[model samples]
Target: MKAGYVALVGRPNVGKSTLLNHLIGQKISITSRRPQTTRHRIHGIKTTEAGQAVFVDTPGIHASQKRAMNRYLNRTAGTALLDVDVIVWIVDRPVWLAEDDLVLERIQTSAAPVILVINKVDRLEDKAALLPFLESAQQRHPFAALIPASALRGHNLDALEHKIMELLPEGEPIFDQDQLTDRSLRFLAAEIIREKLIRSLGQEVPHALSVEIEQYQTEGKLTRIAALIWVEREGQKAIVIGQQGEVLKKVGERARQDLERLTEGKVFLQLWVKVKENWSDDERALRSLGYAE
Candidate 1:
């Protein structure tokens, strides 16, 4: 059986996490439209009769125009591409790909073989417009395969999985076949809560907020989880909590539902909003959130 590391490198909102979830057949990572949704290297393992492929989903590559912490996210993403048996360069099929010129150039130089995965095929109403992309991928790079699949719809994922097996070098499985991700359950819980906030609260607030699971304890049929939602400003916290704390309540209820599903037990979730005063700018805060200092 073949086994090796494969990194998913691409721009923001291009379905990297979705594609990774599709490949692993599980939601090991959270996804959102906002850039930098994925800040750490999350490894999602795909096991089949043929072999095991560990897919590493990196944060989207973006020009660091926001802050030093933002640059750290990009650097963490870059680290994933440095060494791997294969690289899957995901690009949106219907949406414009020109914004990723710099990212594409970086992928082009990777020593590992690149596979152009054109995601969002299901979105393209006119399939005819994809020809240029289909043709150029093969001609432009040392691509092992140019696979078109709807990562969100689970189309052609079997083919992509098979291709990964074929390309993977002979080696031992990096992780257990039964295990889906390298992150702990606490980490998953935190990300899930963060995702709910991102979805309900919108981009401006979620980007400025960081989640921490201070207490996670099992109690009979219920799991008690206390999560801190850290924001940069008190005014932002006010918004997060919303009028009469309705917004934060909704966020907590939604997160509890998902966490229960993930943990297979009832959840007593407590959420708090606190202002860390520019946690994104402070090295200690960033480090506590798993971002590089």
Candidate 2:
């Protein structure tokens, strides 16, 4: 059987998380339209009769390393490139950007075969441009395979999976057949809350915020969870809380629904907004908030 690890590497908001969720047939990774919504490395495992693919969904690689969080994200994404069986480099647009060049530089250090995935083809206005773009991408790197796919609409993903399985080496499954991800329920719960926050708030506050699960307990068919939403400043906290607590209430409702679906049980979720004073830029604060390397 063919079984091994596959790293999904790309620039910010290039649909890496969307591709991973589609590949595994589950939403193990949180996705948002905003760039840098995904900050952690997550594993979405897919086991079929052919083999098991331990897909590593990483934070998008970007050029900015000015902040501590930015450096952490780049390190996390670069670390995933090592020792993986296959590298699926996803690019949303047909054309490559300077950030894509950044990703290329990192993956060049790895010996594993790379597959260049031109994602979001369904949205491409010039379908005729695909071939020339693919050819240009080929000249840049000796990719094992070049596939045009849409992770959102589930187009050409089957072909991508087939190629992945083919490239994987022969071995026993690394995880159980029924397993969908390596993350714990608590971790996923925090991510769901964070996703809701990212979707609910405007552009300025998403990256400044982080979610921490303060309490998680189960009783019968119900799971009670309390999550802390950490923002960088008091103004951000006020923005998250909103007028008359409307924003926080709405975020709580949305997060609870997803948590219920994930846990297969009723969820009692509580969300509170607090200030951590530029935690994203503070490496010590980041480690305390679960950004440890």
Once superposed on the true structure, which residue ranges of model 2 sit more than 4 Å away at CA? none
**TM-scores for every candidate against the unseen true structure:** 0.95, 0.99
Candidate 1 off by > 4 Å: 94-99
**lDDT score, candidate 1:** 0.85
Clashing pairs in 1: none
The 0-to-1 C-alpha lDDT of every candidate, in the order given, reads 0.85, 0.93
Kindly provide the TM-score of model 1 when superposed on the true structure, using C-alpha atoms: 0.95
Residue-level lDDT tens digits of model 2 in 1-293: 98999999999999999999998888999999999988888999999999999999999999998999999999999999989999999998698899999999998999999999999999999999999998999999999999999999999999999999999999999999999998999999999999999999997999999999999999998999999999988999999999999999999999999999998999999888889998999999999999965
Which has the greatest TM-score? 2
Error of 1 at 183 (Å): 0.6
Candidate 2: residue 221 lDDT (0-100): 89
